[model samples]
Target: MTGAWKKFSAQAGITMSEPVVEQMFGGERDPQRVADERRWFAHEMRASTYWQPDAAVLRAATPRIVVGIGGDSAGQLCDRTSRALAQSLGTEPTTFPGGHTGFVEIPDVFATHLRTVICEG
Candidate 1:
């Protein structure tokens, strides 16, 4: 968890202080709850956990949509993911502020972009 926090802080360009770090790790008072959440996320990432959506139903009910790619994301992962999603949705990916966790790091800017996307669509 410490390593993950450090990586996240670096990726998000957040300056972490000792008190904030302590509060973050120390807030997980319930060990069982944390373990359960971790297990749930692990299970969710498994390929078998996903179901194929029906294309016909998807096309019939799909609304105007845009795929948002994080402008500050490192490497090509976010770009590839956004492109793939956009292709699947038949829409172009729109670049948004910050990285993969952009919404958390830059909530105001992200919210503005999100609103713009919805309004423009």
Candidate 2:
């Protein structure tokens, strides 16, 4: 997944590869945390394969606002998914700077954008 993450980060317009890698594999002494992460990953995989939500119920429960990653994330799968989700939610995804790790990679800008969105709602 290292190569994949690198590709993702590149598309995200961020380059904290060392920190990302360390965060992913650094907990050598924390067996419990590792085990928990494993369980969560398994659960996520299973859920992704089987989970489906009712659209009407989802629409009723969902907020109408959406913000999507801009810049280098263009043409990426995550961007496409974000657009699709916004469409399903009956709104367009507003573009913000950075990508998947934008909150971490560009915290000040991302936080400002987030505040603007939240305040608008």
lDDT of 2 by residue, 6-116 (tens): 554565444666876667756364788667756755566457535544556667875754547565577665677677777776877888878666778798998998889
Instruction: TM-score each candidate.
Output: 0.61, 0.61
Question: When superposed on Cα atoms, how far off is each prediction in RMSD?
Answer: 5.1, 4.6
Residue-by-residue lDDT tens digits, candidate 1, 13-117: 556687887777556557886676467546753453254445455556658556688887635545665576677766667889997779999999999989988
Report how far off residue 69 is in candidate 1 (Å): 1.4
Per-prediction tally of clashes? 0, 0
Model 2 regions more than 4 Å off: 1-23, 26-29, 61-63
Q: Counting only residues 3 or more apart in sequence or on different chains, how many pairs clash (N, Cα, C under 3 Å) in candidate 2?
A: 0
